[model samples]
Target: MDIDVKTLRTFCEVIRTGSFTGAAHRLGYSQSSVTAQMRALERQAGAPLFHRLPNGVRLTPAGSTVRGYAVQVLGLVGEMEQALRGPEAHPQRLRLGLAPALAYGEQLARISRFGRRLLPGVQLALRVMCTAEIHTALRNGDLDGAFLLTARAPRRSRTPATAGGPDPTSVAGLARARTAVLAERACGTAAQPGRPTEVLVQELEFIPSTSASTRPATPCRQVAVADPDCPSQRWLPEFLRLRAGEPPESLELGSMDGVHATVQGGLGCAMLPSGLARSPYGAGLAPLPGVPRMQWTVSLLAARSREIRDTHREGLATALRLALEHAA
Candidate 1:
């Protein structure tokens, strides 16, 4: 009948990390102490919260219900603390992560400026990272949230599931692959609805470099960011194999600018976000016909244990959406 905020906090941490050991490490407590807190919490709730698993724990239905309330309770507690301390006494510091592909031109600067003005007393800390690193940082509680470029799920109406439907292995192979990997897995799991919905920001076209010569002597190479194995960039090599009729040679660049520069120099063609390809920076690039379009949604992913205020989170998402639009 009596559960304290500290217990709820520990419970949320366990859910965020998916293990008591991880929660303990993050909370600077002994694993046994975390175990005791969970047991006590279960006692207070009069039901099992999590089902023990070999690798980690999973929330039972009761646990899931408890978690929903726990998050709200914690948020209210946070708001109370903030209200009592006042904005000046406890300034909000949001550590946000972003992918390099989304930082073209002056977009990063634009985001920082807009975020500051919108939040007023808040400090916006931004880190440019690859998709994989961003996900990892979010899980580990190192970042408050992240803006990722995710592939949009195909509309149910647009998707055909009837008999004699389009072959899954046909020309739309890359599109199907992208949907399975990026949309259903990355974007789908990253943000839950209501708390902070994923905002559709931009659509990207993965174009083959026009700079490639038509001569057979000049083979088109696949250009990608250094961390091409991440979900967003991972499909490029496969796309090339399907598009070019062979496993094309690949050129890796550390930054999006470098990739664009190399591709424009005719070294190779890279899959580019539409924002970058359509910008003044991409003046020389031409869109590849018959290529399927992938829409990117900016997901606001934060540690469930440390929820950003709903207003603040939504405002930041709006700022990002508008900033990207202006930059584009």
Candidate 2:
């Protein structure tokens, strides 16, 4: 038997509110209309969905099964309607994420220009985010794909198996991810003159205190990090404190450019992706001492499933690859 969409919706609302009266209030319908619609729905299904309790209503086993299918149907209908809204109503849209360190670089502007030129009529929006947030958004379906910087998970982010399974979209647990390595660059500590030239990001560990082993060779450095939770360098403060065993003095700057400039000005030092550290923009700062050489990987990642396998996605990925190669 065919089910009317309106009646199905009313049934779901009734189950949700646990009372016909409440569902009517929520749906802006009268009590008589709600009862009538549900009665029609029950007649079509040939089953009584609710057991009338003195306090409220309870779903029969069949109602429980139907409720699951009702949710799925409604979701599909919503998707279909959105798709049908057409360019006149809802323009084709894609949310592309990039780490701020990458966003402020030549890559983002170039890719955006190229996308506008190549994919006419597509609304390509930019989302600047930390690598971790980018991964989380990708998993949650908030972002379509991104140029994400990959790094090791911080100590606090790790947990035992029982706590929860790894989030599927997280970089560590990314399974159905289709990706292309956009670029590979090492991260380094930004230094002033006379500071070490190639050390690990955890600089304070090399310096010994009263309880520690050796004194710092250079001046105790001030570190500058980005303030926004989504900025590429947001992880620096934590990484420094945890890995270095002793935290250095840190300053939080508003933007990635601010962090770069602050490091170059001899005001403080910073941890930077090699791309940023070596760029002409960062010429004033020197590399820290001792080459720990941890490579920061930049990748264009999309969900492996049905979310992003289409002409627009393919075009965006291709545009990114070509632009990055030419820049390199």
Candidate 3:
């Protein structure tokens, strides 16, 4: 079967992600495009490759056989390309990932411009995903770098870089990464009002929802949280439990936007990073009272094993700082 490297790469991504939509997102292609590419690959192979399922695609027997050869072919192609282009040659592309919450506004535009300017001919690709996914991609070498939004410097963050020669799981190299304090605001309920402020918002009432008909007196102001895998939203539940002595009513949303919309609609309240709370994402949401204000840190991170030139690292750091400053 005749297949090109680009098509092979797309096939691998689909297999890796287990869904056309996910592969499209990672490759920056439309979902339909990914679907068409897979169909074409199947045509070439003269057999079906995947069994479509409600949750995700599963490989067929034919697909499993193709995968072994495809991997070998891709590895050989990579080796050929590397040999053709001397080891000392400059990198032509850099793939970077960002936490979903920080992937909006002009910050991305600013970073893109700076990246192009710094690398000259290098093509910079940015993808938005959960922090855990970003870390996984960096460790797998699918991403050259990432921008992470974390609650704050936890004790583990104090881990020293180079202690064991580039541990991807620990905060080793990332501890010294250039960090920006996104915002310091109260972590509590939000609703129609002005932007987040130093003061804890106390205007929200426990309005009961009609959906909770079984218990009329029960408060409908559920705690809104993003997907479980999202690092930025992970702290809300525990904080609520600590403040209220029990788990508050929760409304799990698929995305940060959904969480913000729920709170803005007066249906629920959310505890989030103060910076995200102040950005346009949290616009018109007032922080609730009782919950303490917390600081959120956004860091530009690179894998320690990746040999990024100091100039390139500084350029990326400067871009992030400038973006934050301009946003401010």
Highest lDDT: give the candidate number.
1
Residue-by-residue lDDT tens digits, candidate 2, 1-328: 7987788788877866888999999999999999898778778878786778887776653464455456546645754686787757665667777665555334554676688777876756666666556656765668777765443332221223322222212322221122111111111123322111111112111111110112324543566765333323433433344445666687775445556555645566565554445533334446543212233334566544444455666677667655555443
lDDT (10s digit) by residue, model 3, range 1-328: 7788888888878877889999999999999999998999999999888889898886654664466456556655754675577757645666777665554333455566666676676555666666556656754667767766543443222223323222222321232232211221211233523212121111111111122112433333477765444433544455445445676677775444445445655666665433335533344455454333333455666544434555555666666656555544
Question: In order, what lDDT does every prediction score?
Answer: 0.62, 0.52, 0.54
Give a tens-digit lDDT track for model 1, residues 239-282.
Answer: 55665668767666645655665565566666666565664445
Candidate 1 TM-score, C-alpha based: 0.56
Better of 1 and 3 by TM-score: 1
Model 1 residue runs over 4 Å out of place are: 1-90, 151-207, 212-219, 230-232, 289-293, 305-307
Q: Number of clashes in every candidate structure?
A: 0, 12, 2
- Candidate 3 regions off by >4 Å? 1-91, 150-221, 227-231, 252-255, 272-283, 304-307
Candidate 2 regions off by >4 Å?
1-91, 117-120, 151-217, 227-245, 304-307, 323-328
